[model samples]
Target: MSSVESVEEFRAEFRGWLRAHLTGGFADLRGRGGPGREHEAFAGRLAWERHMAEHGWTCVGWPVEYGGRGASTAQQIAFHEEYALADAPARVNHIGEQLLGPTLIAHGTDEQKRRFLPPVRAVEELWCQGYSEPDAGSDLAGVRTRAALRDGRWTVDGQKTWTSLAHEAQWCFVLARTTPGSRRHAGLSYLLVPMDQPGVQVRPITQLTGTSEFNEVFFDGARTDAAHVVGAPGDGWAVAMATLGYERGVSTLGQQVGFRRELEALAALARANGALADPLIADRLTRAWTGLQAMRAAALRPGTAPSTAKLYWARWHRDLGELAMDVCGAASLTAAGVHGDPYEPDDWQRLFLFSRADTLYAGSDEIQRNIVAERILGLPKEVRA
Candidate 1:
């Protein structure tokens, strides 16, 4: 079949499946989890994800030999878009499925693929990324986490901050300094470390949303098998960059779908609260809609589109949160729940607060600009301290 025909068929089949399955308790999961609200219905979402794996829905973009459907890029985009339209629970395995899976496929050994791909595709083994350190958030190359080879294992020691879902993850793909004196991006090794070991400690960091989805993970002599390293021992910079590249791949189309839903809901809220009567409010809403369209268009472009798309949507969503607060006016100042209750932030409040970090994570806005300037635009490099 033609690519267009296949995408449409995949969309129809996926949409039908979602409608059929999103019933009973699962139906309530619509619009429940993502970003600031990843804590919502964790167990149910995990079960639901496993159910998707059972039905061959998870990892749709991976090769069929690796337990995926071997879907084309168009089909994968269709699945994500349809999933967002259905308001399905946010996927817990996205780190594994979208980021690490592709990286492993591209640079991992055949043994690594055979051992890791199946559990990830099955959604049975959840993974978290251990890239950012306390001192190296945007400057990933400055990571100080070190792993030493001893006997038949690698012993790791260091701390990783902003580790999303590290508390619940069974494993983490860590980029640690393997060579004793290596600086910057050199002498790094990307190793898959088990989270349940005695020396791994996870401390949840509560955010403005009153949730602890992100964590600070301390690895003190934590160990993984020597065979768990991806690529050559000292060439982790290349592997990690490949993983980052996968991080900006086609799954973002689904993210935009979610953004569209949020924008529409904000518009409806404005109408209900008589905020639309204000000319300024209405204009902002229109601009937000226009921005979303532009974002979609930019995302469709090739090459440096990922960096551009990330910069665009990060700023756009942050601004959308501001608009949401403006529309809500005085009501947004108070907690949505009981006054004495443990300060729960409603959806708008959560968006407003949590989105403040959009430009900081993954790659900071400054880092993204540097990437686009130095790499994409062929500009001179920024001076290093």
Candidate 2:
């Protein structure tokens, strides 16, 4: 007999636990000097993530059968809203819980689930998506990465660009073409590739902020068992599309809430400093808030329209970046690890720099709008090519 409470009640119970376990907020100054700073920041983020995992809030949306508390969507949303309201630090294992876990759950075999799910929940295995090759950003069908099976094993060889956190991750969920001479979307496959193996190289790409947050991953003769293949061979597009839908639907909820809260803080800073007397500053703040709210509502939709909120985030966050600099002036533009003003948080700066990817990742904004047109508006494709 399942005796779970209502969504409100569940949130209440979860909130009580959070009040007890989750400690601290954005007091992080990115630690000190060189490697030490990164290690400290990573440790803090990991601790914050561990705190969430220990209390079962990390995977609150997952069912009890998969090591979660079986929280409802309302409960999940409420949990996130409150967490962001309280300014919880970013989770180190977000990619695992948000993108990869759900994809594997839906498309992975029983053996895959048995091998993957527990470690993911426990934070033992860190996962990163290996999509968006240099030539294959918006046009995923153009993935040139090759993964051929011989001697009952997959031998992969190719380069992946803009691969975020590949250096920090232990495994990557990769999409590669298995059938040669099959161009475009055909004969592609998704495989859970282990990165710790030989012939896998990761080189970090320094961003505008000079932070090495993304990587260019090259795989040469990367070997994996046939068991690593997810779903059917050459069905990578279907799995990838489904994963993108989940990301747009569920993952964006937390992000938008966080952005909304950050915008509120931005507004408060404006109010505190008498900056809002300037109409431009006030307007930017208002627009940022409204955009985040609209995104929140759209994120709550049942079925995803190919339109997608991630595209909206990139545009909104980029706009907010310019506005943040406008409002923050010289303070926000400086390098991180320096403590001075509350309003000029580096996370925002990191987000702002990374926000460059907002419209880029999870299908570019133009692609998403095109999806809305073709799928939702029943419009025809414009490109004759």
- TM-scores of all models? 0.97, 0.88
lDDT of 2 by residue, 1-385 (tens): 0126786777677667766665445245222212112323776677667656776667767778877767767777777766655555656787788888888888899899889888889888898888889888888889999999999999999999888679989999999999888888788999989999997999988766566767899999998889999889998889988777666655456667667765877777778777788998988788778778787677777764646555667788778767766666676666656466443337556556656656776688777888888887889986846
lDDT of 1 by residue, 1-385 (tens): 2233567888998999999998988888887778898988999999899989998899888877777788888798889999999989999999999998999898889999999999998888999999999899999999999999999999999999999999989999999999999999899999999999899999999998888989999999999999999999999999999998899888899999999999999999999999999999999999999999998888876654577778998999999999999999999998888445657878889899999999888789999999999989999999999
Q: Which runs of model 2 end up more than 4 angstroms from their true locations?
A: 1-3, 24-40, 304-306, 330-351
- Runs off by more than 4 Å, candidate 1: 1-5, 338-342
lDDT of 1 at 242: 91
Any idea how many clashes model 2 has?
Answer: 0
- In candidate 2, list every pair of residues with a backbone clash: none
